[model samples]
Target chain A: MGVNTEPDVLPEARVIAVAGLGLIGGSLARRLAECGRRVIAWNHRPAPYEQARAAGIECVDDVTDLARAVPDVLVLCTPLKAMPDVLAKLAPVLDSRTVLTDVGSVKGQVRDEVKAAGLNDLYVGAHPMAGNEFSGYAASDPSLYDDALWAVTFDECTSYDRLLVVIDMICEGVGDRIIAIDDDTHDQAAALISHMPHVVSTALANELAETPSRNIAQALAAGCWRDMTRVALTDPDRTRAMVEEDAANVAQLLHHMSDRLESMATLLESGDDEALAQVRDFFAVARPYREYKARERGGAAHESVTVRIGGDEASWRDQLLASAKRGEHIMHMTDRTHAIAEIRTALV
Target chain B: MGVNTEPDVLPEARVIAVAGLGLIGGSLARRLAECGRRVIAWNHRPAPYEQARAAGIECVDDVTDLARAVPDVLVLCTPLKAMPDVLAKLAPVLDSRTVLTDVGSVKGQVRDEVKAAGLNDLYVGAHPMAGNEFSGYAASDPSLYDDALWAVTFDECTSYDRLLVVIDMICEGVGDRIIAIDDDTHDQAAALISHMPHVVSTALANELAETPSRNIAQALAAGCWRDMTRVALTDPDRTRAMVEEDAANVAQLLHHMSDRLESMATLLESGDDEALAQVRDFFAVARPYREYKARERGGAAHESVTVRIGGDEASWRDQLLASAKRGEHIMHMTDRTHAIAEIRTALV
Candidate 1:
């Protein structure tokens, strides 16, 4: 994850084509337009085009015509399913100097789609981890990206100059916490956390529906139940598509989560106090990590780099072998007890 | 379950001995003191008694003075297991007219213990469904009980004259939404809604603790995760006690929940869109129940009789069954809805 190394501020793009005028597209357009960039908005349906135009935004109905405008940047804000076709529509008219990116949930497939559409040289897969329960232009807010993660998925063939430019744009919308993650890692990790949790919450709420005791359940559910099931109220078809499209990775995560739950159930059933104690200890250990993330929201924490490893035996061994690989080199490092340990190498 | 019946408000008692000066006890004492009743605070530990005394409240460290003080009401405000021993201590010198009630989470066990102690005629089982994440006397706020359910568990052979007094006391401490329920239904319903969800949330938080990608998971977790897992930080011993004592009922609920989740997983694995749509519809149907409950949280909403059922049957069935049964018929009439093809009957 790229957090350190001074931010590369690129000059503003002259003309930007946003391929979908929904939540992401509208928000991005509003922000960029406010910052004095000419944003050309496009939507499949004609409804959003008017809204975009009414807001003093440039609107284009045809992808080819929009592409023919030869904007300095092309931001594909369409849904995952529509991304490939959108790319294909613009591929023939694309300029080599134009930088391309998207605001999709999953990065792996988008990366593949970019390659298959022969736009690898132009496109940099950017997944801004920002959204609301609501979708569409009316619901969009420019501040939606204010202090959120914008994961710029990168591979060896990705243009470093274009990646930096996209990063600069993302940082402008959100804060300067631009993460550089491999496409696979970002997608798989997202599947484990965001995608799977949504499905679980929806399932729980769905199960309680039409049940005899649902009224009492509703009465008893405090802040906890509300938070746990809020995601259930979001559009199911959109979430379903994301999960099904990344079925294999999502399935793996589901299996892992299920196993964890099963173990917990076993401990509860057997009255295993020791196991329960261990679980409690785990929560205590994880508390700092959770608090760290909570605090990291709305602001950048540090200028430090995070190293990523693939999901393999080498990854496990690397975790053990890589001492302070988290951007910190040698120097006085604090141990678990908060005592400083002297190291020979220079610190990052 | 008791619904719309007029609560027999008891006359103000001369002296009330609160047998646990913790959050609920402290809050109750403050309310009673405010209502011009002299409350004798007793705590097994001396610290809270001192804290209570500092607030201009009378405190007692000894249990033997129950006979000497001869309070009209003896409130057992300890945990469920402690109730029996406290009752036994109070029994030796208890007055015949002395009414006893408890502030325990689980009602069925407390009812059984009160019966076994031969205090059935004098004992009333009460559960004020209100709380905060924090505990102890310092954390107590009298208004915490404002507009909350004060469920009074009763059965055959209970003195009607004494029941009114208990109901009035609860109404004064909390708002007058006094619900009369049987011990079995209270326990079972509570297991379904309160206890089971707490267990589920805690288990989920614990599951996430062990993941190598917990940092990523935590970062990706938005308002939904924070809201959902708020209950995961519950005091471990209290959680253990709840599940352990009510293991049978809680286990059944867990089984039901597990089955639901497993079925959902199966549906996802099979890629069944029709089943998924049905699941979504179920959640939509269940939305009104939660909304109604949310509406009733504050205001004159509490003045109306709210008859809530513990099972999955529609709201109409709950009303019909409550009306059809003898225990339910005696309750007062308030707001109403109709069940399918059910014969309409007036509340007695």
Candidate 2:
């Protein structure tokens, strides 16, 4: 099926107001500024305001200043708990023509809050599935949106043309393969894929920390351990808000995950080789399913690589002399402790 | 408490046999060759032998050749299941003074197998906590061993001086972080840190596969999914071996992990804000543990960074030109995309 490609090419945006200056807000501001929109950024704290200014962004320190900007598009990039009041305060500044969207984790709660505030005509919910372990404006990559899934939640009230304009603008920024779903389903799925994993990883990390094995685990942990528990290092406040806001769905999925792990444990405990073999068989069935979904996100199976480094700095210089004298692989020599270089030969 | 510094340095190895030519064996061969040892490499297949030959390694196609070579040290680098027979066959070659070690996961089983085969004095179990997803001789780097842990297992019959010589050899190949642990404790710890996480990641990927919302999930799954499910994509045969060999310990750890996740689900289902808060608090306590470990891994993290690309190959060259003409921060390029040669600049 062909994707809809119609662009709502409005002549200009009057003003674009961003609700926060975390990673998303900062990126959106930069992108809007690139598109020649007069961007006004708002942050509650003095910290991000300075960061915004350093980036040559025009900053509004207060909500009233944001209201005065009279944005044609008001993007809420605040944490979930902070979204309701920000939406409420922006309602008076917003009109039917003004477009609003959020970069929040849970869409259903935010969508309900927007509708409850009686600004349904001016609002939609969106989640840009891109992030780094690091937060704040410094970590915001312009290409963070590229190849990510920007899930736009729509109901009957969402204007077709307005959605197109927002989609085009997002595509111009850090764009990815976009998926459309309604608020409820989008929220439930987000809980399953995103929020639930965070909760699981954090809980696992916590269990590791609480065990006597924690000390030994630290020594034994490799890249796999680091990768598996990475989300455990996320800002607790941000994840707490996400879990609390979408408690029911996260709870449901967590139950399902727990049950699956429990079954796996039982099979392992029984020491029945056939049962354990079945666990591997089950994963074989699951692998292709995951591969299919990952492809939709424009990702492929990651390219595995091997790297070889030769010589310490002192030995490197000696190697350079040895290679030059012996006419070997060493070229363009530089001296440093453990020089960053790649192997030209299959050293092993 | 000071570690023993005056441990015996091994006499130059007159002959050495490596039973596999994957990451560990390839690396061992290279180091042994560099250390002036006569190294004979054997692989289960001939392809790695070809690559080893190209790298100037002496390759022997048959395991019987190992008996005639009569290597002073036999470092078995095969999978766990293949260890016992490889050890038994190598027994004919082992002299009274011969020191032996095997680079395998789950040291306890291998330790027992070697003892059962009447080579207790000659055998030591070693696990090098370093690897990439890629395998085989071509992917092997001599430097892959640098600055990683070599967990060495010691038992009642192990000679002090012989242990030190093996430890010295491993330290030279890898790093000086040679942790000495009993076989049982090592197996239990491996269960916690390595095997348990594999089960968790595989089950998680499986869970995501079965979810009705996978279509939306595929788009939204980012680094978290990639990180959590990495072990899911690991070689199934290797995974099965690790799981079966240490079934009891892995089962115990899985029970603990399942219980933690269950409680998290319960809290979410009951909408216990306080309990949810506690879960977040638990993460707060756990995040530092991982952060501390990351700091310890140090330069190993840099090993994974892709090379940066810039200049004429940039896709955003036109955009950069336009932004530069418009007096933006397009001149302040920092990070560059390696593949696309795109210079990422913050637009001021």
Chain B TM-scores per candidate, in order, are: 0.77, 0.73
lDDT of 2 by residue, B170-213 (tens): 54433334555667767887887778888888877777667655
Q: Pick the candidate with the highest DockQ.
A: 1
Error of 1 at B45 (Å): 5.0
Question: Candidate 2: lDDT of A181?
Answer: 63
lDDT per residue for candidate 1 within A284-307, as digits (tens), equals 644544444454454544543333
> How accurate locally is residue B114 in candidate 2, as Cα lDDT from 0 to 100?
88
Clashes of each: 13, 1
TM-score of each: 0.77, 0.74
Question: Interface RMSD (C-alpha) of each candidate?
Answer: 6.2, 14.7
Write down the DockQ of candidate 1. 0.26
Residue A156 in model 2: lDDT: 64
